[model samples]
Each structure stands twice: as structure tokens, then as C-alpha cells.
Target: MRVQFSIALAHLLRRRRSTLVSLLGISLGVAFFLAVSALMRGSERDFLKRLVDNSPHITVLDQYRSARVQPAELRWPDAAVAISNVKPPVETRGIRSHRSKLESIEGWPGLRVAPVLRGSAVLTFAGQQQGVSLSGIVPARMKDVSTIDEQMVAGTLDDLAAAPNGLVIGQGLAEKFQLGLDSTVSMVTASGGARVMKVVGIFRTGNAAYDEGETFTLLKRAQVILARPNRVNRFIIQLADPQQARTVAAGIEQAIGYKSVSWIEASEDLLSLLLVRNIIMYSVVTAILVVAAFGIYNTISTIVVDKRRDIAILKAMGFSATDIRHIFLYQGAVIGLLGSCAGLMLGYGMMHVLASVELKPPGVSDVVHLPVWWGAEQYLLAIAFAMAACLCAAYLPANKAGKLQPVDTLRGAI
Candidate 1:
């Protein structure tokens, strides 16, 4: 085995140019794979972080997911008769008896729940009017469940509590209205009820739509403006472990009989899209390594052809066909091992360089660096994939060399 390995090493060193080319190909492929994977996975994680941070882990809405069964349908069991155009009974749009429902979920461990009343209102200022989403919240509870406190650029949620008529608006809205702190904005609800609220806070969330169209006020204030006093339509929930949101949301829905949606459920489509994106990205990057394998195959194949007489002489001197096969396989393994190591180093350097690069995105106030995830698993994956490709590439030539008859090869050489 040692003699076989030594011969393989000598052969590779003899064809240094071809060997170097193959090594370079494999190394470059592995390097690019690592760099791309780190960046992509890092970006994915960063995006999810922002998404989870900005939105509720779970939201309990005032509506039911399914329509209520009619008394007629309930009374007549197994009736095939179809009920058509059954208008559900008219009731108030907001959640009924929300206080009791909120009380029922109180004291649940690792949960922060805040009641909110969301409605659309038109903000009129300086003769300019824009429609905006208004959310009514308890400043104290909201601070526990929301990232708005961290995202606040000026003033605070507590300020809304201090002043009943205070409003929190996003920077985009503030800029659009050309208003600042203490600026008064006229808000008219869907019912034509109007209220004058002073802007006490401005927040920037880096999302244009939210920044431009979302506003917040005290829960009581929102009820008065929307003309549904003492009613709350939504409960925003944050969990200590966001991954447990689905289970908690289901439990909450069962407990309170309202529609509870987890962030995972709400963003299912986006998650699926990301999964598909990752699959495509890995497939494309893996193809580079697969292509690089061809270089190894060609180099090994050429060596096998060029070293036929040497192989024949070795076999004539009592070397087995298995020994010849091992020689070629060893060459492939060496190339794989060395190339993977060099590639990893290069990839790490690339990741650092990428992490250092900063770009100012449009409409963003601060420069952001590239996200690079440094997971050991990705390194293992790259090496495993590259080595597999190398081994597979080596197999064909090894098998062919192993099949060579010493007598036939010597006759050809002579």
C-alpha cells in the first residue's frame, strides 16, 4: 500500500501542471461554494430576524376562521339540504367582551400579550390628506410585546401614555406631512369622527410601507376616534421562544375562540419561497464542484494512460491489480484533501472581506454590512461534497487501470 501511494505521488508530481490545474479547479469550486453559502444563509437568517422582530409572534384577531353553523343545520343532522346566501346575524365588528378574553390569557408563562384596536384613518395636515393604519395600544403592554420601542427614533411609547391625545407616526409619514414633534394632525375615522392628535413620537423601521402608512395611539384614544369605545379587535403576542409560537397560538385560539395566527403560519409562503431559493442556490453551486471533478477525471485518466508501462512493470514484479487501483485512488484522495483545506482558507478570507464591505441602501439611514454566517456545518458540507466528487472522479480511472493486463500492456509498450 505504501509503495502504491509513493508511486501515485510521484506520478502526480511528474505531471505537476495537470495536477495543479485540477487542484486549482477543485479549490476554486469549494471556495465559491463556501462563500456563497455563508452569504446566502446569513442573509436568510438576518431577514428572518428582522421579520420576527418587527411582527408579533402570534396575533389573535377578533374574527373566527370558520363561519358559525346555523341552528337549522345543527338541528337537522345529516341533512343534504344546502343553505344558500345565509346572511350571518349582524353584530358589532369588534371583538365582543374582549376584556374577559384578555384576562383569560393573563399570567401565561413566557408570554407578553397586548390588546390593540386597528383601524384605518385619514390624516389631514396642511390641507394634505393621507390614509393610514392606526393601532391603539397600551404603552406598557406594547413595550413588552413590540419592537417599536427599540425602533423609536424620537419620543417614546410612554409618551403616548402620558398624553391621551398623543400619536406615534413613522418617519415616512412625518416627512410626507413635513411635520415634527408636537405637530398636530387631524385624524378622521371611517365613521367620519375626527380627532386632533399631537405627534409625540416618530419611528423608522426601514420598511417604506409601514413607515409611511402606520400610526399608533392609546387604546382608549383609538376607540374614541374609531367610534367603538371599550372594544379591542386584536391581541399582539410575543413569546420568549418564538419557535413555540405555533403551539401557543393554537392553544390560545382553543382557549379564547378567536383566530390566532403565528408568525410562522402567517409567513408560510415566504418561508416556502426561501426554501426553494436555497435549493436552487445549492444546486447551482454544487454544479461548480461537479464540473471541477471533470478536471480531476481527465488528469487521472491521462496519468493512467501515460503510466501503463510502469504499471505493467510493477504488475510483472508481483504487484496486484488492486495495488494499481489503489495508486490512482490515492492520488484523487490527496488532491481532494489538499484542495479542500486550501479552499476553506480562501473561503474564510472571502467571508471576512465580504463582512467588511458596507453599502448604503436606498431610503436607509445607516450603512449595512454583508451578512455572513460562519457555520461549521457548511464547511463540513463543502468538504464532504468536494471529496465525494473527487472520489467518484477517481473511481473510473482507478477501475480502468485495475483491469489492465500486464502482458497486454507490456506487448503494446514493446
Candidate 2:
């Protein structure tokens, strides 16, 4: 077997140019496959981490509200006219009874719920007006549902108590307003009333939507401004395992006898967007692999034709047809192994290049760098797939060589 392998190696080496071309094709395909899979996996992981870190795995809200947009304060001012345009309601209920249920929810296995009051308002600093989303939370309770404690860039929510009419703003918002922790900003409610708030803290979420629009204050204060006393917009639920978000969401809904949803379910459109991107990438990679497989088939067919005389001589010497087939099959396997190794290195190199560059989505300035995941499964899958393609490519030519009549092969014209 060793001798046969040695001969097969020499045969492949003899046609170095063709071997190199075929190997390059295979390597390119495998590299693309590896890189894309790594990118997708990394993006998914990063997105999930951000979701769980800044927000919650599950967010329980009233059945009447759509999860995509912020809660409304009231029925549209012109219900019939607004229904014609399908605008989100201006007013959303924030009943305190919903928050009162958190105690029972916290007792459930693998579940933690935090009450939050979120509403829209306008803030004026230095005569400049900016719209903001006001979010109210108990400092300790907020920590139970998110990484708010870690995201504080300056000051503390604890100071909110000392400074009545105090609020913690996002870094992005502060920068936009040119305000600081001690700055006083007057917020105008949707109802045209105004309240002055002392900026007690600033935070950065690295997400524009949140960091640009969110302002945190005591629930009692926010409720007074929004004119919804003792009511909350939503209950953020944290789970032990985010993977179990859907299951726990169902349990929470069952317990509350109301509609509820996980972050994944709430953000179906976002998930769908990711899914579409991945599908497109996978399709492109698959096409490249198919072309590489065809190249392998052509290379093996050429090899068969080139070695016709040798095959005839071996057969004449009583080498079985099965032995002839194994010789070529083994050659294909070696080609696959070498090409796959080269491909892995190529893929890793490309990932390194991507890591150095800053990439951001449109309408956002934050750079979301790509992440690399070097998984055992990715390596093993590349090798197995490449080998399988090569073996399949070799079969037709190898079988044809094995079936040739020795005399016919030997007497063949040039």
C-alpha cells in the first residue's frame, strides 16, 4: 500500500501545473465556505450578546401593543383618520398591576422580570430641542434585567435620589446636547407640559437607537410627566439561558394569562433580515464549491487518459481491476487532504484581513468589527466535504480505466 501511495504521489506530482490549478480551485471554494460560516456564526453570537447585555432575552408587554415600536400613550388623537394611515397609538397603558406581578414571576424557574416605564418626550438644553425616549427604572431592579450597571459611562443612578427631578442620559444624547452630569435639561411631555431634570449620569450602549434616544429617570417621575401614574410600558425578562427564551416566554404568558414574547419573536423582521443575508452567502459559496468539484472531475479524467498505457501494462501483469481503481481513488483522497489544509490557512488569513478593517451599517457611525470563530467542526467539515467531492469526481474515470480490455488499451492509437 505504501508503494502504491508513493506511485500515486509521483503521478500527481508529474502534472504539477494541472494539480496546482485544481488544488487552487478547491482551496478557494473551501476558504470561502469557512470564512462565510465563521462570519455568520460570529455575527449571530455578537447580536445575541448585545441583545442580552443591553436589553433582555424576553420582553413581556400588553397584548394590544406592537413590539416593533415603542408603546403608545393614548389612542390616536384622530382615531378614524389615523387608522387610515396606520400610525402607532400615541397613548399606551402602563398599569401598575402588571409590575406588581413581578414577584410571582421572579419565583418561576429560570426567570427574572424587571418593570420599566418608557415614553417619548422632548428635551431642551441651551435652547436646542431634541426628542428623547424616557425610561424609568429602579436602580437595583434594572440591574436584574440588563447590564445597565456596567454601561454607565459617568456618575451614578444613585445620585438620581439626591437630585430630585434627576435623569441619566445616554452618552450620544449628551454629546448631541452638549450636556453633562450636572447640566439641567428641561423635558417637555407629549401633553405639552414641561419638567426640569438634573443630569445625574450618562451611559453608552454602542447601539445608536438606544444611545441616541434613551434617558433614564425614576418611574414615579416619568409617570408624572407622561401622566400615567404607577403604570409601566413593559416588563423586561432575563433568562438563565437565552436559548430558552421562547419556552420561558410561553410560561410567562401562561402565568400572566396575557400575551407576551421573547426578544427573538419580537424582532422577527431583524432575524429575517439576518436569515436572508446568510442564505445569499451560503448560495454563493455552494456555487463556488460546485465549480471546484467540476474542476476536480476534469483533472481526474485527464489523469485517466494520460495513464492509459500504464494501466494497460499493470492489467497485463495481472493487477486486478479493483487495485487499479484504488490507486486513483487514493490519489484523489491525497489531493483533497492537501487542498483542504491550504484552504484553511487561506481562510484564516482572509479573516485576519477583515478583522483589521472597520465595518458599519448604513446610517450609523459605530464600527462593528468582524469576529472569527475557529471551530473544530468547521475544520472537519471542510476536509470531509472536499474529500467527498474529490472521491465522487474520481469514480467515473477510475471505473472506466478499470473496465478497459488490456489488449484494447495497449493497442490504442497514440
Candidate 3:
């Protein structure tokens, strides 16, 4: 093995230029692979962070996956009654016995729960009318499952809890309606309920649509204004570990007989798009390594042709076919190991350059730097892939060199 290594080292050094070119090709290919992967994965993590922070991990709505069965259908499991003239019963909206359900859900571990009565209403300030979504929230529970408390501009959720008739509106709505803290505004609901409520808090989310059309109030106040007594229409849930959302949502839906949607379910389209993007990204980057492998193949093949006389002499000196193959394989391994180390250093430098670049997103005011994931797996992946490609590239040439005939070569020389 020492003799083979010494021979391999001598062969590589004899054709230093070709070996240098092969090393450069592999190193550059690996460097770019690392840079692109870091940026793509980093951006994905950033987007997910914002989504998990802003949206509920799971939402339990006052609805079922399918239609509800009649009481008679429940009573008679196998009875087939052909009656077509009966009119369907008109059911009231909102979840019944919401308090008991809330208590039951609160017993679950690793989750935060809050009940909300959401409705649509008309807002009139100084005789100008605008429509908005009104949400009734329990201040204590709302803070646990929502980041709205962090977006407050003038007042807090506690202010709404303190003042029963107080309403929290968006900053854009406040500006458009010329309303501010302590200003009186009239809220009108389709259920023939109307009240003049005070604007106790204002929030700015940087999203024009959300800021201009959403308002919040106390849970009891919403129940009265929406004309639904002792009921809630939605449960906002945030999990301690967001990865368990799908499982938790499924179990909750099965237990409660309501439609529970997890964040993964809600963002299926976006997630699919991200998946497609990753596939395309990997394909493009791996092509670089594949092209670099061709250089390795060419260098080894050229070395075999140039070293034929040396090979014959070694074969006459009692070197086996497998020993000859190992020599060439070791040459490829040396290039791969050296290239991987150089490539990693270059990739780290490139990542630092990318991370230093700052950009301001369209909706927000603050500037954030480019995201660059520094996961160790990417480094391992680059080296493993590069080494594998190089070895595969070297295999054919190594096998051919191993089968050389010393007698034929010596006869040709005579």
C-alpha cells in the first residue's frame, strides 16, 4: 500500500498541470453548490419563521368536514326511509357549548388556546361608512396564540379587556377615518345590533389590506354585538412545537367533530412551490459537479496512456491487477479530498459575502440582511457527493490500466 501510494503521488506530480486543472474544477463546483444551497435554505427558514409567528398553528372552526346527519338518521342505523318532502331544519351558526369545549381543549399539553367570535360589521365615523372584520378575543388568551399584541401602536389588548365597549382598530383605518385613541365610532351588525364603541387601541401590521380592514374587541362584547350568546365561532391555537400541528389538528378534529386546519394544510400551495424550487435548484447545482467529474475522468485516462511503459515494468516486477487499479483510484481520492477542503474554505467566504448584503422587503420598514444557512449537513453532502462523482469517473480508466500486458508491450519495444 505504501509503494502504491508513493507511485500514485509520483504519477500525479509528473503531470502537475492536468492534476491542478482537475482540482480547480472540483473545488469551484463544490464552492458554488454550497453558496446556492445556503441561500435557498436560509430564505426558506426566514419565510417560515414569519408565517409561524403571524398565523395560528391550528384553527378549529365551527364546521365539520362533512354535513351533519339528522337525529332520526342517528337513531336508526340501518333503516331506509324513502321520504323526500320533509324540509331541512334551519340551524343557528356558531359552536354550541363553546365554554365546555374550550375547557376540554385546554387540558391538552404543548398548545395554547384562545376562543374568538369573528363577524363582519359596518363602521360609521362622522357619517362615513366602511366595512371591516370584527373579532372578539379574550385578552389573556389572545396574547398566547397571536402576535397582534406585538404590533400595537398606541394601546394594548389589556386596554380592550379593561374597557368593555372598547375597540382596537388598524392604523390605516384610524388614519382614513380620522379616529384616534378615545374616539367614539358606531358599529352596526346585520343581526340588528348597533353600538357606539371607543377606539382604545390601534395597531400597524405593515400589510395594507389587514391594517385597513381588521378590528378587535373583547369576547363578551363581540358575543353581544354579533348576536350570538354564549358561543364562539373559532379557536385560535398555537403549538409549543409547530412540527406537531398536523397531528394535533387531526386528533382535535376527530375528537371535536369540527374542521381543524393546520398551518401546513393552509399553506399547501406555497409549500409545493417551495418543493419545486428546491428540486430545480439541486438539479442545476449538481450538474456543475457532474461536469467537474468529466475533468477527473480525462486526467486519469491521459495519465494511464502516458504511464503505459511504467505500468509494464511494474507488472513484470510482480504487481497485481488490483494493485494497479488502487494506484489510480487513490490518485482520484487525493484530488477529491484536497478539492473538498479548498472548496469548503471558498464557500465559507462566499457565504459571508452574501450574508452581509442587506435588503428592505416591500411591506416592512426595517432592513434585513440576506439569509445564509450554515448547517453542517451541507458541508458533509458537498464532500460526499464530490468524492463519489470523482471515484465513479476514475473507475473505467483504472480498470483498463489494470489489464495491461507486460509481454505485448516488451515485444512492441523490440
Q: Pick by lDDT: which candidate is best?
A: 1
Model 3: per-residue Cα lDDT over 1-414, one tens digit each: 999989998989999999999999999989999999999989998888888888999999998888767777778857888434567668658877888888888889999999999999999988899999999999999999999999999999999978979999999999999999999999999988899999999998877889999999998999899998877899999999998999999999888888999999999998999999989988888899989989999999999998888888899999999999999999999999999999999999999999999998787778989989999999998998899989988888999999998888767752
lDDT of 2: 0.79
How does each model score on TM-score?
0.93, 0.81, 0.92
What is each predicted model's overall lDDT from 0 to 1? Answer: 0.93, 0.79, 0.92
How many times do residue backbones clash in model 3? 0
Q: Per-candidate RMSD vs. true structure?
A: 2.2, 6.5, 2.4
Candidate 1 lDDT, tens digit per residue, 1-414?
A: 888889889989999999999999989999999999999999999999999999999999999989888888889967889787898777657878888888887767889889999999999999999999999999999999999999999999999988889999999999999989999989998887799999999999989899999999999999888888889999999999999999999999998899999999999999999999999989998999999999999999999888888888888998888888999999999999999999999999999999999999787779999999998999999999999999999999999998888898888843
The clash count for each model shown is 0, 8, 0
Error of 2 at 44 (Å): 4.2
Better candidate by lDDT, 1 or 2: 1
- Which 10-residue window in model 1 sums to the lowest lDDT? 87-96
In model 3, the Cα lDDT at residue 65 comes to 87
Instruction: Give the deviation of candidate 3 from the true structure as CA RMSD.
Output: 2.4
Alpha-carbon deviation at 281 in model 2, angstroms = 1.9
